[model samples]
Target: MKNVDIDLNLLVALDVLLAEGSVTAAAQRLGLSISAMSRTLARLRAATGDPLLVRAGRGMVPTPRAEELREHVHILTRDAQAVLRPQMNKLDVDALDLTFTIRVSEAFMAFLSAVVVAAVSKTAPGVCLRFAPKPDKDAGPLRDGVIDLEIGVIGTTAPEIRTRFLFNDRLVGLVRTGHWLLAAGDVIRPETYAACYHIAVSKDGNTVGPIDAALHALGLERLIKVVVPGFPDAMRIARQSDLVALVPQSCVGNHQTPDHDAMSGLASFDLPVVIPDFKISAMWHPRRDADPAHKWLRDTVMDICRAAYLQR
Candidate 1:
């Protein structure tokens, strides 16, 4: 048998043909005339020495050889796209209307929503953002391109996923403005912190955390009267009662206005214990790592988060 040399366009055409399963539909997908698509399919059949697709009823089905080659075609097309995308450096953000889906926890959304929305609108008037609740640290959405980005700690990630650090976040104590803890001193001591009734926030529903460990080191433990999944809920409960909640400072934000930014009802203070700060990262599939529009969005988010952290 003789060898056949294939190019990127040929691979893309085959991929589309196999996906659409009809010469007319594939032609539509590739924006080609029916005659041009037929000729291309005829060329493909001759090059591969197989009837790449055949009629099975009123529609076409991929032949066995085509079936076997389908995945290879997809991978090659994606690789070619990734290889060539870096050459595309020009991006008209305001002219392109695209929707980016990002997954994050409730705290992250509350912390960065106002800033991200304002920046994106001011720069990319046509682009929109759709936020999905991050129920877990699953990497499936990023790998499969189901979501554009995932914002969280880089605890673990698939090798193919690309990640960039957004900021380093530390936990702080939150309480209502008139809470008794505020009246104690400028900085609440570990004993003072542990003495108050506490509201613990954990996504995994575990009541124990690093704060608890630090308190235990001092031979003391706080009374955790509540366990909840979200920082906002914890704030709500703490504000209404005498409990103090430890949460990320990033979650407490100000509503922006022309005059000044107004802080939310929740107030934050540094934790008495020395808990390590966790890193927040923006993760995406490598296939989109080099695309100009995607690159802009990623950098934009990193900038917003950095500014927010600086302000706090």
Candidate 2:
């Protein structure tokens, strides 16, 4: 690449020409006269030092260089359009046609999916939502635009990402109904709870976590019988066996049929140990902070979560 003084407007003309493959068609697409499009193509060729298009039997064909620049040119055009568009007072929710990728924990999805879906459907009918598995709290995906929103505990979020707390979540204990522990207790005591075999849920496969730390405070420890990567998986195991699962309270909803049947053999109780309630928040890149549609989405999601919490 050499230092060349080229007007950015020529890049759009080149993009249109390569896409249409004919000056007349490009001109029609661009709202320009055929002669004007021809002149623009001439300027583009000079700027790139290549006859970017060559004449075929009846139409034009992009040369190798023009083919190479096609995708880049299209991306540049889109970015330029985004920058030049006038800001709107409110998002046109019903007309939104954007795709948003959200990174979230499986626990959040287990509880919040229906609320999120209903809220978004009522507002942005054309918007598509992609949920990416969140293996950790690293902010790389959010910063790089791979993830539009992150829903999880607020602790590890990057300083630059904007976050709004959706709700506070506390740890609770779960077991199969008619379990021995529930039969023996009015209130779960740390000693008996720690004596039970535990089914742990850890994203990274670490069996020990804040739950263990809370137990350690009372000089007790639960023997982890199994370790899984998500809350739903742990609950599944607990529902089938004698193992106890400590999970977020908000996550245990009306059980599915099999689980509902399984529940006749299990029980749920508040954890005897004290762990600080964690804040689950929705985080997004600052670049989209002012986007009307994105702002609407963020607000809608927050409202849904808040309403769900109140109703619960």
Candidate 3:
């Protein structure tokens, strides 16, 4: 084929002329005068080497070549229209298929996994919720869009992230049922609580937290013998041993706890020293703040957390 340059505008005219047939109607449809349409038709004829439209009895008819090219031009015009159109505003959750990664602590997932899964599955059948373990409080995943949402305490200092309060979380002491602190006649005090071998839960694997600060105010210090990454691990370590695991109240498990030693037959008690309750929150990047599907996810998860954790 010979190389040639053709104005894309001419394709628009060709499509219109083929559809309308009469140059008068085509010109009217394109908001061009009859004389201007005639000039454009002449140019199209010279470029395509075909008088694409010719006079019939009282109007116009498409030439063989024009008819052949009609469908192709129509398709191109439709594609261009789609490309230039605004995005749809509604979220068709049932038709939407996507995998959303959420960063959360193991304890948070353990307490709320069933409700979270059920909510997403019922509303958006094709959506997959990936719950990632929180190894650090870093904002890299949220900033880069690798994590769709974060369900934990909102400690992210990045100014570009947004957070919503889900519920208030309190630290509780967890130990095996027969653990000495829970023995029938023992009256627990800060001094007695501090004397037990302690298991502290910290994401960074450090043996310190707000409980330590509270203890410091009282001129008391607990023996933190073990530091684990999350509540479940702390529970596992404390269950078989005498270590008192400090964790969120929601992380405590009942007799229904499966074979995972982390939560089996664990008993919860009020912390001996007064400590402020921490806020658990849902956080996301501002980049997705107004996205329809993302808004649905954030709203749904927030609702589920409120309904499920209000009891805690």
Q: How accurate locally, in lDDT, is each candidate?
A: 0.79, 0.79, 0.80
Candidate 3 collision pairs? none
Residue-level lDDT tens digits of model 2 in 1-312: 568776878867877787778899899767799899989988887777899889898877889988899878877875886787557786577887878888887757887776688778877789888878887788876765557888988756367889898887777889987788898767888999999999988767668778889889889999888988878888788888889998886676432211243244556687887788877889998988988877887887888777766454
The C-alpha TM-scores of every prediction are: 0.69, 0.71, 0.67
The predictions' CA RMSDs to the true structure, in order, are 8.9, 10.6, 18.8
Candidate 1 residue-wise lDDT at 273: 88
Better of 1 and 3 by TM-score: 1
Best TM-score among the predictions, by candidate number? 2
How large an RMSD does model 1 have? 8.9
Q: What digit string (tens of lDDT, one per residue) describes model 1 on residues 59-128?
A: 8888899889987877777677657644545887778677788888675787677778889999999998
Which portions of model 2 show Cα errors greater than 4 Å? 1-78, 84-86, 253-266, 310-312
lDDT, model 1, position 157: 51
